[model samples]
Target: MKKYIVVALLCLTGLVQAQEALFSGQQVSSPQVNDDKTVTFRLSAPQADTVQVTGDFLPSVKVDTPMGKVDGPGKALLTKNEEGVWSFTTSVLAPELYSYAFIVDGFKTTDPANPFLIRDVASVTNIFIVSGKQADLYRVQDVPHGTVASRWYDAKTLGFDRKISIYTPPGYESSTAEYPVLYLLHGAGGDEEAWLSLGRTAQIMDNLIAQGKAEPMIVVMPNGNVGQDAAPGAGSDGYYTPQFMTPETMNGKYEAQFKDIISFVESNYRIKADKAHRAIAGLSMGGYHSLHISRYYPNTFDYVGLFSAAIMAREDKSGAGVYDNFEETLETQKDNGYQLYWIAIGKTDFLYEANEEYRAMLDKMDMPYEYTESEGGHIWRNWRVYLSEFVPLLFED
Candidate 1:
């Protein structure tokens, strides 16, 4: 009994020591949002030769890559203090959600002090929001929030069970009325969770509905990659690295199987299952899907949105599937269109010229569409703005 008592005392003493060490005053607090609207990032790298911080909030620099010249996040060197701490303070930054990373001795890494993080493609970085007019809708405000559910449905067309993310509006649970559905799609290297996590879909929808800016509607987000069941680590092929371009992407496979998603959504949810109450929109590769899917079904979706879309015809014009017979299908879609067709792209986006050509084609065909041109290139910032603008215009009487 005495031996057991001694062992227990030793274990308790070790635990208390660990607690004290964890709670010690040596903790580093990073990404301090100052009152002056400037932000400070700190790292306690005592033996590091050099330290630097790079983020989207800073001015971008043009960097040349194998793909081409592109705008990259700017890096700021951190000054070392007498205590071996390295830190950097930025100037007054615009109100927005920003992501950043630290470079310690040329090694890119996340901030250990910052618990909040988001992954885009394969890169993971810490994120922070600067509260202001533009960023307010992105934050979770004191409003009636909606319910987001991860659902599994059998994709009979693809011969597999797929995962989807659904967002029902604030009053969907108690309300007996059927609601319109907006099918939201993500860009390349993104999954169904892209809009929920990175695009701030819930916050935007909740705030918009609470303020009476948008009508209550259901949102369906499904994985566009036909070869994958879900995002990395979330699928049966567990723990694989996510790539920018996955298999079966933009090969007309996903577009052909899209009806499976709609069929599932309509069958399971209390949705107004008609062309008038349905809408589809996406960014980048998703934009390509939206464009093709809306046209392939002709009289299906009344509203179609393409944000920073890849607008080009495929090499095979043999009228095989969604990619083939593009002009003919688009013309048919235009003739059968019931409501709005929205197209938006950034001025600096690589797809700008292609969008201009598509718009010209539309002009030739006398197809009507609302166009919005933003300042930045292909990015989440512009996509979020496009989504916020497009939702308000949807399901309007």
Candidate 2:
């Protein structure tokens, strides 16, 4: 027994010693930079076919950071002595956080050097913000600017507690004034925090508002996910419904779950409740929601935005003809006096065809709307570009 105890103790000590840190300290994290606005990143897999570093600062470049441009005795070659280890210095970025990732073959991965990351569903995305972009309204600038708050409440209809977040503009408290409200929604699998963390919304909102690019509207973001991992069919309700089917209906749940959000905001903040001051928008699944809500409850909102929305008619692959029930809803939205119904998505997204098809359908339906498309795939870059383009058009009257 004494001999066995000594062996176990030795084993435990070895195990503890084997634990190596991915990161060093509280400040040492990915998405962050060293004091000199530069960083040396390393990955210990020499056997891997090829490795390339890509990030927010560098879009889709097939090379390591610096690539000998920043500091290399050679041209982008990571020199290793005897032990198989690779090291390279990334480019110098402006003072702020920047997101980056190392790509091995076809797979995208985060940098081992930094700790800050944004989870892209199950996969993680390297994300960081470059501070002081035209004095971003929401970033930490000496004194903390306003923040986005994520809170949960019981949604009786869904029988489950749901969540929502609000982006309070800078000086939201100092001024005693009522503000317009923009209800933002995220795509499926996303939660209320997606907009703040992924979209950098608080900063975008603050910057836009400060720059007079966007009106001073209180932006409200809500989770549009189905309550269950699967909804009714593939979902959890013991019913067999299609994917993206929340009990809230196909994007139709907008009026139901989000109605609570409106009531809460109105009750809590100095906000304008009339149609002229209210707005709603989303991306992908959210875009579909925005479409449904804007069409179904035309009287509630004046500004309607669809970012990479799933707004087109569902294609019946069986060639059974006729997909989605849109006629009545179209008439209803037209009957209501809403002003803008803007639609935008990446040119290369799977939903792109649907958007074009939907636009053709809209032409036949005579449903007036705003539509635009730019370069890029179905990702945050397009969404961010969309926001920069779309927000300026809101509340124009």
Candidate 3:
């Protein structure tokens, strides 16, 4: 028994040493942000024939898509060394959060050395931040941060307990203040968690409030897809791949059922609960929802923002719920009075023409609004910039 025990101990010791050596031997520090504001990415794939890096930091090349010419991600080939290690260094990158992946001999993969990553719809990419003025608010600073909670609310209209992400100000838990509410919606293929994760809503809010650039308000993000109970894997469907479009997206169901979300928010949380103190904004499909919801239920949102929004009216306009009374609704919303109606879109956005038509309609009605056009297309980068700029303009009263 003593001899057997000694042998087992020796084997265990060898196994541990092997693991340690294996890790230490192949370990190469990737994503080395150098002193000159450049980034170095290294991958140890000696067996691979070719390796290349692709990221948003690279020069964007215009690609022809169905939505006109949109800027697509660019790639750069990495040089290999004697040790079979492939590496590529980027030129001075601006201070911003960038996502990248490695294409190894035609197969796309992420850096094994870097674990930090983010998911947009079905695609997952590794991310790193070049810290500077552009990304100052993207990181978690030493300032007081707000609490973000994934609360399950009763959606009576949808007949289910829907998931909603809420961001309360830093002192919300401790203070008795009734603050204004901002309903922040995500684009198609996004869920309640989209704004918090991709949009960096909490970080932006915390930094802005800490700097006294924006008012402290509660931000609510809800899943706009009425068919799905929650986000992709978060709903009754388990671990299913996320798609760009889901059932009941633009069929006027979500807009009609949106009141349940508002009701749940008002009843449960301490809010101003009035039109003057309420704001609504979204990107892409969510922007479509925002435009319709704000106008459909006139006087509900005093502040309305459409960020790269899809502005075309439904083809089936038989004067039914939500889609019914389009111009009449806008006129009512205009007459009911609003503090701000902000419309923002990218110059190359596919929906740019649609937005132009919508703006023309608004102009024809002599409706008051603030129009801001940016450079870029239907992408998250512009959306983030919009959010950073938009929140400061909300609830100044």
Better of 1 and 2 by lDDT: 1
Model 3 whole-model lDDT (C-alpha atoms) = 0.88
lDDT of 2 at 38: 69
Q: Each candidate's TM vs. the true structure?
A: 0.93, 0.72, 0.93
Over the stretch 249-327, how does candidate 3's per-residue lDDT look in tens digits?
Answer: 6778788788988998899899999998999999989899999999999989999999999886565321347787899
Error of 2 at 55 (Å): 5.4
After superposition, the stretches of candidate 3 with alpha carbons farther than 4 Å from their true spots are: 1-26, 62-69, 315-320
> Which ranges in model 2 have alpha carbons more than 4 Å from their true place?
1-41, 44-84, 88-100, 103-109, 129-144, 228-255, 312-325
True lDDT of residue 257, candidate 1: 82
Steric clash count of candidate 1: 0
- Candidate 1 residue-wise lDDT, 219-316, digit = tens: 99999888889889999999989988886667777887888899999999999999999999999888988998898899999999999998774543
lDDT of 3 at 257: 80
Ranking by lDDT: 1, 3, 2
Candidate 2 lDDT over 307-380, as tens digits, reads 98876544332222223356776777777867788888766566778789888988998888888987655567
As a TM-score, model 1 comes out at 0.93
